[model samples]
Target: MSTVLAIAKRELKSYFATPIAAVFLVVFVVLCGVFTFQVGRLFDRGVADLAPFFNYLPWLFLILIPAVAMRLWAEERKSGTIELLMTLPVSPGEAVTGKWLAGTLFVALALVLTFPMWITVNILGDPDNGVILANYIAALALASVFLALGGCASAFTRNQVVALVLSVVGCFILLTAGMPLVLDAISGYVPTAIIDAVRSISALSHFTSIARGVLLVPDLVWVVSMVVFWLFATVAVISLKKAD
Candidate 1:
């Protein structure tokens, strides 16, 4: 546990050691505002709810989360520090978990900074705070899922660009799998069981379920299980790479 915390502290500090962390925070915050106000037309809608903000959360994260996660291991390997780190007493699983925790903490901080948006809606009218809370929970869970997936992709490559692209593409496919256009095309020939399974696996569906304020136990379990699976996959990939 101590070893994991050490690595997590190191990883979190590394983000601030350069301008990468600042740029990441600024870009996401700005984009959130733009998507919520301009693209979502919050002013035009005059609704007390934050539906517009949460509606665009998944699409925004598809890019930003990968950008944050791309360098977790790719830079370490590219700069040859991975070898030094692996030489330490720490285990690969611990290392993966630490980096994932650091990324998750950053997302928590980023979302906390967006609280003004919540406050704005509260001040304007009586909104369903319970639903808003659920949306935030869903957003955080979705971010962690993407971070873990991105971490797994990063473990397979030394190039940050490739890592970023792989993470984005992988996550995009998972998202598109739940879209009506994709599912409808598959429905023509695929069996109902397979289609149901695909929809069940897509993170987007679970996100919507939680965003509706229902807090389905299955949706929470699905996100958490996927996150754990990806982290384990990252550990496995690291172990195999070490062998090679």
Candidate 2:
């Protein structure tokens, strides 16, 4: 456990040591602010709610999580540091857990930076703090799922671009599967049961429900299961690589 945390700390510090983290922070804040205030017309509507920001989280995570995850294993492999790490005394599980922890911490920090938006909504009017808090839980779960998926993709290739593209495509499909256009396009030929099943697997469906302030057990279970499954897959990939 201590070894894992050490790796996580090192990984986090490495992120801050580079300009990428700064660039990412600046862009994420600016884009999210624009979407929440300008595009959502939060000020124009005179509504004291974080509806726009929570609503935008699914899309934001689809892109942002991949960017954060792209370099995890890919960079190590690209720089030939993965082999050096493998030769260390650390176990594979420790390494994977450390990377996952670092990525999650980065997401948590980004989410925290958006606290001003919460304050803005509070000052503007009376917002449902309970529901907003629930939305944050759901958002964190969503980001975890994405991070795990990104970790799995990163393990599959040495190329960061490939990892990023694969994670983005996979996540985007899961995200949009429940949208009207996507469902309508597929529902014409698929049975109702199949379409419903597809929708049930969608990130948006679960997120939308939680954003409405309902945090059901199933939603929480789904997120945890999704992340665990991908992390296990990452371990499998690493095991295979070690065998080779």
Which structure among the candidates has the greatest lDDT?
1
Flag regions of model 2 displaced more than 4 Å.
Answer: 188-193, 242-244
TM-score of each: 0.96, 0.93
Query: lDDT tens string, model 2, 1-244?
Result: 9999999999999989999789888888888899999888789887788888888878889998999998998888888888888889998888888998899999888888899999998987999899889888889888888998899899888889999999999899888888896899897798999998888888888888877788788888888888888888888888788523
Q: lDDT per prediction?
A: 0.92, 0.87
Question: lDDT per residue, candidate 1, 159-212, as tens digits?
Answer: 999999999998897777888977998997989999998988898899999999
Q: Every model's Cα RMSD, please?
A: 1.3, 1.8
Question: Which 10 consecutive positions of candidate 1 have the poorest summed lDDT?
Answer: 173-182
How does model 2 score by TM-score?
0.93
